[model samples]
Target: MARPIWTGVLSFGLVSIPVGLYTATSAHTLRFHQLQRGTSDRIRNRRVNERTGEEVELDDIVKGFDAGDAYVLVEPDELDEIAPGRSKALEINGFVDLDAIDPIFFDRTYYLGPKSKDYAKVYALLERALAKSNRAGVATFVMRGREYLVALKSEEGILTLHTLHWADEIRDPREEVPDLPGSRVSAGAKEMRMAEQLIDTLAMDWDPEEFHDTYRDKVADLIKAKQAGETVEKAEPAAEATNVIDLTEALRASVERARAKGKQSKGKQSKGEQSKGEERKQRTGEQSRQGKGGKQGRTGRRQGRKESGLSELTKAELYERASAAGIPGRSGMKRDELIKALEQAGRQAA
Candidate 1:
């Protein structure tokens, strides 16, 4: 594991846990260095005095803030003299519901772990406490000479920390966005239903692996091809942004496309299963599996029933299936309602 960047004690009331903070993510972006065209020489940057047109040493640098007509220069030592006292520690202000913090306030995430083996127990205790209460500790700490507000909460078995933006940093959208909609435009009930259906057809669980930095990949490919002395050209159709002519028609088309994609996916999976079964049958003549065939057949029958539509299952069976599928509000759902909800969730999961 990489060494943590920050180490300190996490304080909650009278309890404290020795902890270390490690960055949770890294950039895989391509980097470039400046070079003159047709030359291999590199270009480097230098700090220069604009008035004197001379290079300045790092030690001579000082930060200045523009104050109307004149600039107010501040020395590094002077700035450090008044730095916040909480720079070396993370003291919890209080715990709040995780949902209470808006997503817009979140900036970056870090993983928190015990600094030593002896601290592991205390760390686990804090993790479980926050998780059970569905709360996160808001705290302040300094890193890289800058103070940050952060949330410390449990994710799975480990503690995760998220840096937050100050409230003043968030801008009001009403002031920035022009002619914001306040029911100026509306959709009919039929149109709304179609749109809802389209959304349901496309609804899916989160899977980060499905996304890629395609443009960056293309740039990397270009770099490689250039080094290998090759020319490449590719074209992809542009995507349509909006269709204002017929909202209902667009929603209907979108629903059909999503459903078609789902069908195609299932069709491919079915083909794969059939192919595997055929290969097994060809190799064994459907007889090498007879040792526990009776038990296997009974189990397969039970599995088949479980996989069947919700309508074919009893109330108890429906409840069990709903629970297994992680459906919300299942306890209050009637048999028919459970059947409909489970069917939709099953399709989405597939």
Candidate 2:
């Protein structure tokens, strides 16, 4: 079992609840070490004094504050004397509406669990109260000699602590972005109706699991192949974005494509359900046409069948189709390039 990184009492008003801070996130990407190219020696970094050109020992290192043109070296003992006691306490100042805090302000999250047996009731009470009120507690805590602003919120009956960025840390967008007064667009009545219909056809409940990190997965697969000493094929270059000159035509095509996709998804789901039912029926020794053997036979034929729409067409063929459909940048497309453009166009249409 993993242990809590910090332990402290969570205080708000007259209420005090002992809590433990546990990390809520971790990095999964594989890490590599630096080494000498020719030799099998591992490379390491060193802290060297610029003036003396000598290496400095870790014990001799001291924290320094640059004030104007001079560096004021702070002694280790002096820092320890003024340091806040290693208290893991989260002292909540006040409660704030969840929407009041911008998503950008959130840095890292941690699970705040009850530290002691006596604190369980109070911790549960606080968690339930925050859930009921839909408010997050703004708290301050000192960790590793640095003070941090934290937002304490309830998640699935458990309390969660999220570190927040300071106000000054968020840059002003106006300073970096240019103003474009004429870029604002007003949708036409017909366009608005078609757009709404498309949205309604594609609307579904939010499921985060439906999406995967395709790029990361592909990278991992490449690494695995390389490790196994397999020759990796070079990936084709991506197709450039198509320029659609006719907005009305593009919008109409997009709506039609979305409706088609919705129908296709429904059909696939129904077929899958039917297949499952058939599998269950075959278990009872019923010699039905919808048996496992029949399903496997159909799957075998489907596997051999070529894709009629985009899959069957070569890159050059796709490019020509896209060009004929009035897509821009079709003149400079190679076979691979055309395939991507056509796929994108088809997606936009569906």
Error of 1 at 148 (Å): 1.1
Best by TM-score: 1
**TM, every model:** 0.74, 0.71
Report lDDT (CA) for all predictions. Answer: 0.77, 0.72
- Would you list the clashing residue pairs of candidate 1? none
- lDDT for model 2: 0.72
- Candidate 1, residue 256: the lDDT equals 92
Query: Model 1 compared with the native: what TM-score?
Result: 0.74
Q: lDDT by residue for model 1 over 1-350, one digit each (tens)?
A: 78999888888889888788999998867899999999999999989999998999999998899999999998877765676456658999999999999999999999999989998888889999999999999998887768899999899999999999999999999998999877768868998898888888989888443344656657776887999999667858897777777777788888998999899767755654454334333323323333335876555433433444345767656675566556787765656777777656644644
lDDT of 2 by residue, 1-350 (tens): 66998888899999988778899988755566799999889988899998998999989999999998999998867754674553456788999999999999999999999877877899999999999999999988777667789899999989999999998889887786677334475667987898788788778877443333545545666788998998666778996554645667877888889988778766755654454334333323332232455676555323322222445765444553564445676654545566566545544543
**CA lDDT, candidate 1, residue 302:** 39
